[model samples]
Target chain A: MAVEVQYYVLLSMALFSIGLFGILTRRNALLFLMSVELMLNAANINLIAFAFYHGNLTGQVFALFTMALAAAEVAIGLGILLVLYRNFRDVDVTVPTTMRW
Target chain B: MIYEQIAFALFAFITLASALGVVLLREPWHSALMLGVALLSIAVHFVMQAAEFVAMMQVLVYVGGGLILITFAVMLTEREDATDDTETNADEVVQT
Candidate 1:
């Protein structure tokens, strides 16, 4: 591979940080979910890059597994957001502070 | 080698920019579109590394399934911000 693995690492890092920024700054729950996905894909990029570098299929396998988990996560997350909307009539993550114990 | 370098630079830029768009865009709808762009570019990154299956799945799962869900949420959860503009437009139509 002419492209050094370093480039992938840097790209993934930038993507992950962008996700983190979204999570930290945005209050809307759906935006938070998207950011989390961004972070997850960043990790996947690393796995695949290392897999290619090492000449094994393990990284690709795990990347598939990660994709599965991400799918399930979004499903459950959207369900919860639906409920959050029904209960609070709003999707603001902060609004659930009313659930404080 | 030259082509690989150029492709990496191009897609890396695309991935980063659209990712930033997902974070920085004010409207959830627009953010969803940006997320789609970001995911598709990430898939390209996968292809560059010879993970063709992963790239296809990225397009199928992330863009097809995940993005649709996100757009549904954005549409369903659209609350305060869009209401006024819609209301004003409705009133204008009635007056006309």
Candidate 2:
């Protein structure tokens, strides 16, 4: 019972869509970062699946790098979040006093 | 082989459900906890895909490091007296 790559693709797509929905609907900056993480994991799943399909370690290695980058992204994102809160007195993205659309 | 399929089905369900929880939950702390579940299950998925080392790193880096940072942000950013925490303008979701 070998699993098809398509199953993984579909799963990844569903996960990515959920992330997108979160990003679109949620105003919490932390949730926004978490949704970005979900989207990144979706991409990671694809890399690992295709690596398994091709019988190589490249995808796994790249996934590791992606995780490292994700960790760094979270670190910086949290820094910005703290600053946003400090200045705005709220976490709502729409209530910022410094930046406006 | 059959067991692998079963396991994939089970964990994939966990992954998606918790991911939804991460988004739809009322509390950001709850969402952060849900994010932990989603991250760990994703590690299990890496194991299923035969990337054992990646699975380990996923747990170590994502669950251990990344999730901790997110939780800290939630704790640090949220105010104790502020109770009006709500999403802003659901109307903007459909707009360009």
Give the candidate number with the greatest TM-score. Answer: 2
TM-score of chain B of each: 0.83, 0.85
Tell me the TM-score of model 2: 0.92
Model 2 root mean square deviation, Cα atoms: 3.4
Note the clash tally of each candidate: 0, 0
Chain A: TM-score in each candidate? 0.96, 0.95
DockQ of each: 0.44, 0.55
Give stretches of model 1 more than 4 Å off: B83-96
lDDT of 2 by residue, A41-89 (tens): 9999999999999999999999999999999999999998998889876
CAPRI-style class, candidate 1: acceptable
Clashing pairs in 1: none
**lDDT tens digits by residue: candidate 2, B1-96:** 888888889999999999999999979999999999998998888888899999999999999999999989988987665565445445543331
DockQ of 1: 0.44
Q: Which ten residues in a row have the lowest lDDT in candidate 1 chain B?
A: B87-96
lDDT of 1 by residue, B2-96 (tens): 99999999999999999999988877899999999999999999999999999999999999999999999998888864544322133343222
Q: Tens-digit lDDT track for model 1 on A3-99?
A: 9999999999999999999998887799999999999999999999999999999999999999999999999999999999988777777667655
